[model samples]
Target: MPWRDRISELPECLITKILSYLPTKHSVKTSVLSTRWKNLWLTVPSLLLNCHDFPYRQDEVILSFLDRLLEFDPDSRLLKVKVECGGSEDIDGLRDRISTVIQRGPQHLDVESFTEYRDDDDDNFLYPFIDYIPLSLYTSRTLVSLTLTYSGLQDPGLVYMPCLKSMTLVKVHFLHAADLEKLVSGCPALEDLTLIRNMNPIYADEKVMRVRSRSLKRFRVPFSHGKRCRSSVKYTLEIDAPVLERMTLGEDHYDIIMVKNLTSLFTVDLGIKFVVEFGVFFYPGDLPKRNEIRYFLSGISSVKHMIISDKTVKAFELYSNVGMIPKFNNLSRLEAVFPFKLLQFLPAFLECCPNLKHLILEVYYSREMEDAFELTDVPQCFLSTLECVQLKRIHEWEEEEMKVATYFLENAAVLKKLTLSLTNYPRYVSDEEIFEEVNKVTKRSPACHILPDWGLCE
Candidate 1:
């Protein structure tokens, strides 16, 4: 058939919807495509602008674009708007543009590096210090999803975003606990929330952050890696979400944690970095910290799937030495990373996860790893419900590591599959040689099949 422009024949609203997905720069370029598409770009109802997408003078170019784009239809409601600029010198221009768009009623808004600046005195760190934001943003009636990076949030005297569902604040500063609490409280319909605090030395003071919401389902506080110089500045996090399904607490230490009404919580990522320095493992003397750890674990004892980091494993070992680790009778899937030395103590930790069905144990080496250890007793999961085990990240094919595999093979009566994912193999050892050695381990479950994975090696 002869060439036919079928797309152009679609309704003008449909064409505008298509243009909304393209970058504002690309959308404007469509003006030259045809007479019909010329003014159509102006009605896109979305602005997706990035400084790098333009030529030199990133700030000036974006500011100019925003000035004209908003001026074209200043009263129209924006469905989505994203403004990402790298320059900090002329950040006010970007913020003004953002504030202007917020008042125009945007459903989804994302602003990154909007206020990140560096001081000459502190050449070591780039401070994400935002002094103010449009109060209208927190009370946005049309906003459904909001993401602000490198920004500061002031207590917006009142917050009532009736339609907002998801919010992500990365390196965002809140004047105090009340500012965050106020912002979260205003979003009545928020379902997923992620708070990644700025690691600036300024926010090192002790503070309490409470999150209470009825509609929230997923919440996360990812670990922010910075100088442990302010490790002593502890935070007390309090959460009261009745229907929350998933939560991730990645801080190295929390002085006090209160998680309430997480009856619906199913999965948890416990990447708690026990307040301890590197190379020093024994914290037997810190009974208060031990109590804090036990208290936090007790709140989420019903989580079905759990992920434990290496630092947390050490904390578990320490707590296990002093007292009982919280029992997770409901946990079915468990993923944990352990140093070579902590392998012997795995049974002690697993004893609490009596109903675990799937286990992924990642073995690695650390300089601070203990020299001598003893496997006290076998866990109940190994003999009962445990069906699948994945021993991954195996760097050293040492005798003790092999014994760990044999320990599971000889104990997990219900195990159906055992996967060995190897990493960092010795130059002299062959793949067949390694597999042959593992195959020799006596299996307690006759139906269990052993599988070797070389993907990690590649």
Candidate 2:
């Protein structure tokens, strides 16, 4: 083939489009392809960099490459900038350089640094662009989304971003919760916010900070702190967002007062710690008790879909008054782990949520059952609107298990499918025995399938 013909056959625009998805390093290498490709990377709309992508000693080379790319088209509208680097010294230098670049103000910035090693004297070894966030960059009105994952971040004051919409902070240490509250309040149009960290003591002078976003739609705050620290501090969230639709409460230090006024919520996920005795303590408390478990669930009266962790299910029985379980007239989906003893609450739940169409039971045993045929309290009537039943971990078809299956088959008039998970099979009950019992118990299902590994069911 003639060289001219080969060149003519190639589409320069198509080649540039393909190179746009490659990392900045690989994209720059395209310059060596031909003179026509020398400036191809400069026109690329996205840039991503990580210290691990290239040799550790090549920091200068990486920095020079980024500088040349930015210089090539200083006016270009960058859509994304991702920088992930490690090592304390590399991070400190990188932080300074990144701070300078951020001052230029890209529309989107995602910066993460993970280096746990410290100097021999116990002082933190700072890496490039790791310790401090470029405060000047937060003031940029052009930023639409920003995510930062670092070790310790002190208070970031009332930094305003008129056009900012989404913000995510992970492993950030705030000097005061008010600083975080101030940052959220300053984003006039912020819509999404996520915070994941352990508990820190609230400042003495800091008032309970309330977040008020007129355009906010989703909020998630997961606590990864262990039991020791969580039990001591009370974390409170004050939200005044009329447009809020989805909320996820995670971690142990969260305050129960935040959800009381969220009148427009549609979906809620509560990650409450399950302790039977702890739950019983709040059964007779005030209208909206201080109990973290009950207070979180009671606020979402209008939710259409609800997810409660296994811990929350075990704790529900602690409340002597079943009436505390909020009504969800519009609820259609419910996912929860069921304690064997809590099986009795199924009937009451069905009565409350008449429109529920799906029920997912993640059965967790208290201990190994010695007598497989022991009967437990199983709901007698099947939910009329239930169309599908999913049972996880069906090793043994004890009398209680058979009674539960038979009740559902007899009462679920509109039921269409039943799924059984045979995880850890034969070890608990022989497959032959479980299959025979299921065949005898199930009556109105159109299809029934057994999955040895429940993870594959989805």
Candidate 3:
């Protein structure tokens, strides 16, 4: 029997549904396959175009494709539109395309403008000069999720996005700090907000980054280690989210953080270097700034789960020395990354978390460490509430880790389980040997069981 082309006989809606998964460029190619698929790409519900997909003079090609795609069916149900534009001088063309997409009432829009090359040594390199986009983007009523990278946002006079639930701004230049504040305030349904400000010189100059939102739930300022602005000025992070649940703060420049009305905070992952000035260290002489850090800690003290970075542990160690550590009575699960040298101060840091039940310790290597501080008294959590302890991400096991394990096993009176996972161990020792050595440690709690884990065996 001859083939009857059963696939092409499927409903148009189903055909477009299948085409939506493929990029618009690839989807358009299927139009030549058969007459049934000729106009299917136009109503695919998604227009995902990338400048890299097209060869030489990519910007013009991208604009041309978008023009044809959008002009084909003005009322087509474009659920999402993602435009990844490589380094280009034609910013207006990209903005025009985005404006047209906004008019089509897309639910999701993601645009990323990547610079081709950046010369750190070149004094003329101004880091991709991108002008502000069209005002229609901010006024998008149908956009549920919007992600923009390496872009500039103009003065948001009257921002309003009623359905926007998630927004991510990566290195987006804002004319004024109030622009961000107004933009966030206008989004009534915004729940997830992320700001990647590693390359923003304006943020450092503004000195204050206020994130005030009532409906925001999960917020994050992802780790920007080596990617800080060249400006020497430090910034302040003022957060006033009444209903925020989870927040991740990862930056070194925002030394002074002011948080308020975070009543529903469940988890907080912290990693702040607290280097207020560019070249200045956070010395003990700086009492006012140090006190501000205390205020920031007390603001989120009610969080039930906290994942702290190794830098935060160092900050906590410094705060502990000056008696600036705040009590985290509500914190039940505490995960902290500590370097081998900082292991000595873990006990003192734990003293602040009196009700901590679970402890996840990830130890790494560091070259520079502060002078050792020894604590004579045991942490209150270790003696009472702490039950489960997991030692993970151990690149190399050393004597300091063993001492920490011994201390936890001997002091955690109610400890029920202790799991250890080793990765990239030294060529000399085996996992079995490390397990045997850890097993020899004395357990104060009779019910304690030691378990060894080989994480995700290759």
Question: Which candidate leads the pack in TM-score?
Answer: 3
> Between the candidate structures 1 and 3, which one is better when assessed by TM-score?
3
RMSD of 1: 4.1
Model 2: per-residue Cα lDDT over 1-458, one tens digit each: 65574642568667656766788789878788778878887887667787677766477777776677668767766677888764454433566667656666678888876535345546565322326666676577788898887634556665789888898887654556677777787888898988764344323433354577777889887656545434344556676777789988664444444555667788878776532232333444544553554555566767888787766655455553643666677778888777776666666655666678877777655455443432333332243567777776665566666666666666676777666666653366776777666766553444443333344333
Could you tell me every candidate's TM-score relative to the true structure? Answer: 0.85, 0.75, 0.89
Please state the error at residue 152 of candidate 1 in Å.
Answer: 2.3
Cα error of candidate 1 at position 364, Å: 1.4
Collision pairs in model 3 = none
lDDT of 1 by residue, 46-89 (tens): 88887777776566766777787789976787889887764555
Worst-scoring 10-residue span by lDDT in model 2 = 372-381
Candidate 2 Cα lDDT to native:
0.65
Candidate 2 C-alpha error for residue 107, in Å: 3.2
State the lDDT of candidate 3 residue by residue for 1-458, as single tens digits. 99798879899889899888888889989989988788788889998887777877566666777788888877776898888774655545777777878888999998886443344566865444555667888888899999988777878788899999999988777777777889999999999999876344544345677899999999999876554434555566789999999999877646577899999999998877666665344776678867877888889989999999877777777767775688889999999998767777877788889999999988775535545534356899877899999988655566656766777777788888888877754545678777778777743345889887776322
> Between the candidate structures 2 and 3, which one is better when assessed by TM-score?
3
